[model samples]
Target: MYTEHPGSCSTTGAIGLERTRFFPRQLITPDDLIQDQIYFRDKLRRHNRLLHGWGVVCGARIKPGTGECEIVIEPGYILGPYGDEIYIDQEVTVNLCQQGTDGNAISPCSDMTDPWCSNIRVDRQSNKPYYLAVRYAECQTRPVRVVGTSCGCNEIECEYSRIRDSYAIKLLSELPSTYADPMPQPNLDDVARCTPDHACPACPTEPWVILADITLGAGSKVTKEGIDCFAHRRHVVSFANYYYLCKSTTLPVVRSIFPGNGINLNNDQALLREWAQRPLLKITFDREMAMPKLSEPDAWLRFWQLRSDDNLTVVRRIFLALSPENPPATDESGFTATYQLRAGAQELFQSRFLIQIRATADTITDTTTPPNLLDADFSGTKLSSEQLNQVWNVTDQTTLSIEILNNLSTTDATLPSGDRAAGGQFHSWFAVLG
Candidate 1:
């Protein structure tokens, strides 16, 4: 038998297959047909795992139920780690909040959670966070036709004629460990299929689909503090949209960074054509956030720098603009003192720009505080510099920065802030320019 794999990563790569060649009057055994069926089945499983990827598509929300320790999992679609599709038409409720009261009862190491709570949770003495996940499952059933029922040779056909596709909802202490991309040693079946290197990574882990991290006290009701759904829950966009993006069929062309923020962009045909050619990546501060209310002036962030020619771009820092960019990319004094994207005259705001705050009333004597952003009124509605601390009626970080950045040029980002609260949390998305 011959087999092949694509790309450098063998485990993730697709496996090659072989078909039996039959001649007239050639005897075909049950093994030959079984192999034939497996080939097609493996083909589709690989497609889903490799190309489409895996994650919860929609509606696997964890919500508090009427019971003290119960949580409801709304009906949803999930793609398992091994590319198995799990569709729950109705809501599945897993009770993590309670367990049986029998003190002497020995609990199963793990309960088999499928077919909607077929087993009960075994209460552990201590209360800790349980990692909830789902994984693809299969079972052999539908026994039919005994051995030698028809054929006189007494050779058994297939013991189980059918395989059922199912899923399991499990509570895990940690993520299941990953195994070798493929099993090292080869058995008869492995030799035929798991060829080349003979290791398949997904075999061990069951490729769990993590639902949430939850904790429940002995008799406490489920509360917001116990369940953290967003921490581990991975979101998957619709397949059609993601597939289009994966192929790069349609490129995103953004005309302005601050389109609806009252900043008119330079939309000349020449510039528009130029922008169409270059890639644009941006972070939009959509939610309102206030500057950290603190007593010390030096504690606040001075200059939030944008990308420079010398700066090493870090994609992770897209949303955490308030935090410092590590190792200090550039010492170059920015061209603009204002909050403009570009430094030069032909500015369309595509360039990554720095965000500077008006830390103090005196921009010159208190140079460490940087300059006021937005309309030069970083401290809005405040009567005195002493009262410029975070208070009621203070504009959000975005609004306050606009006022100063609109007036002056950006400063050096050599100095950065460590405070997470200083920056507003916002969602970041990326698109490629054709």
Candidate 2:
């Protein structure tokens, strides 16, 4: 006999023997899988929301000033039994919440009356969350105003005007009530009735005076005879082979040199003869003819021409003239000239020196002579002044020394020969101009 049953299958063997086997039926459907997916997605969203709330709480605690709170959301994935390991990650949304010091919910509102209350919000384009911060201040009661007597009319008026211009009415209202009131309005009638005293300011008794003096040397005396004054006074000094006439007076004084005790020269005589008449001070030469002419029309012109023609050549001549045995001091192959200004303890306003040199070159050669012979190889380096006003503003008892460097490499060149060489001279003089 064969029997049939639900979820059971019967099979007969080839010899007519019977056997029964049972198979389980499938109960789950496609709808159930869909429901499972929804359930997991909702769970992940809830977890994300909880994390965002936590982030907001953390931000609010450390919020700076009056800034609001911020929140951030992150998305991720998880493995599951459904589909191909179910999608565990979902889109995350950030939410912001305002909380008070008591941990209770509060609105993000800034108080206008409170100067310290401030609100701020920040947004970022990256995955970083938005930030909010709030700063709060304790409220205070307004104080009563107190009026006080106002004096110093001018000063009070200035203060009132400044405060009114700078601060708004609302800010002014917040000031302490005890603050002084605005200055009283000016009295037009009283101002009109007052007498006007229009006297000019008092003038100074002695209007400042500038005195300029030029001195020759320690023992030498400065007299009106040696000075030629036009708009200013000119002092003459002799140093080495040259005579210098430096203007020693300021711009205001105008005294002619020839009228008073100035140098008297015969106009009919030769220019050279008149130059010889001028007294030589603080300088001496071996021979009379060695002194260059410094008389009339051409004397001044020749003086400047010698200096401007070739400064280096003139400097070498002057160096030899000062002391024939003392050629410029040598540093390796180069030469240098040193000069000392012996002011002693005298304090001077302005000091100037005029130097002159004259000599004939007996021997000249490209190799033996200095390169760029015409260039001013010797510069007034130590005591040199750039502008006119760069006066030697020295302290009391201080003496100034100057060094002149010679760029020539003619270490082998011998000094000039003949009477002129022995008699050659370099002259310099000092003058104070204030």
Candidate 3:
């Protein structure tokens, strides 16, 4: 019904009479409906009623594939106050309601539900256009008498004169009581206050208020009274790597409660003794406060003086080594020697490694060449970042087999006096006595 125009021509019988029809005679009739026999006219009336309520009417557009079909029912009406002689450029508010099966618009008139509009579907298919059906009571009431004129005349001029000249068929001099009152806005202050600090509208006491200086290894100070302050959160205490939240008063209490909360030894010797065998070391301090505050960069620098530790402990020279076979220290005579060098354990944070190969000379007879000082030859061999950890242990008891060659230009090495051993460099293979 929406697709076909009224003035499309059709051909007929052998006489060949071609005539124009205002509407397609092949429209879907109520008889074609599955259930109701009289649903078509009712649906059309509902469509017209909704259109009028919204200041709109249905307009048909010809489909491209075939001239007989209509694409959609377009809105053809405009909104303006009577006698205003105005040009409207904006959409008018619509009054919407749910559509019943009988094609009538229904509104909420009961106490159970409040006034609200729903989308009215003209057809069940997903692709079809639907109307937002607003109820009559929901729309604003205005007193104006208007008459529609013929379609062929200038619509704008005809509509203007009809609205300006017509008499009112219905009359109500006074405005409705409900219409005069201003709409009330909902209170939002309570809602704003109800939100948790971490949620929307964050409260001042929210936990985890991101602090710039609370990075790893940072610690705070506490005063005798209760002033808990932090130094520059910028300090990267090798022990930890996160930011610190400090309190002046609680720190002293925590220190007293847990004496070993941080490094305690006042002497380097004692510290060394305790940490000699330890592989990795970490130190953390208690800086919990009753109420923690944000520690911005400027704020931390401003409070640096108050939290500075005057007698700060320093980490002296520390040696680290990992050798599965660390040989004993020796003299030039290849003599077995005793070593006191501390074999330090690898720390957790270290990425590289250190290896030492100590050899003791026992048999040094000082003969001819005296086994050229075993020089570790580091020549061509693919070595990468991962292979840097490799270590070779060469002790006094280790043996080496050397083979020197002289190139004779020919393949035969033992041919004759003129064909001396093929000349080439000597190859030495080092191995343990075992």
- Which candidate ranks first by TM-score, i.e. highest? 1
Residue 211, candidate 1: C-alpha displacement in angstroms: 0.9
State every prediction's TM-score relative to the real structure: 0.39, 0.13, 0.12
Q: Write the per-residue lDDT of candidate 1 for residues 88-186, one digit (tens) a residue.
A: 667766666344232111122232334454344566333676767766555555556675567432226546557565555666765555322221433
lDDT of 3: 0.20
192-305 in candidate 2: lDDT tens per residue? 575586332222121111111111212222223322211111111213355778633221100111111111223324532423333112221111121122111121111110
Q: Rank the candidates by TM-score, best first.
A: 1, 2, 3
Model 1 sits at a Cα RMSD from the real structure of 23.3
Model 2: ten consecutive residues of lowest lDDT: 163-172
Q: Model 3, range 291-374, lDDT digits (tens) per residue?
A: 111111111101000011233211112232222243322333232211222334322121111221111131111112322111
Number of colliding residue pairs in each model: 27, 21, 40
Considering summed lDDT, which 10 consecutive residues are worst modelled in model 1? 425-434
Candidate 1 error regions (>4 Å): 1-16, 20-22, 97-121, 124-127, 147-159, 177-206, 218-220, 240-434
Cα error of candidate 2 at position 366, Å: 31
Ten-residue region with minimum lDDT total, candidate 3: 299-308
Instruction: Give the poorly placed runs of model 3, Cα more than 4 Å off.
Output: 1-180, 183-185, 190-434
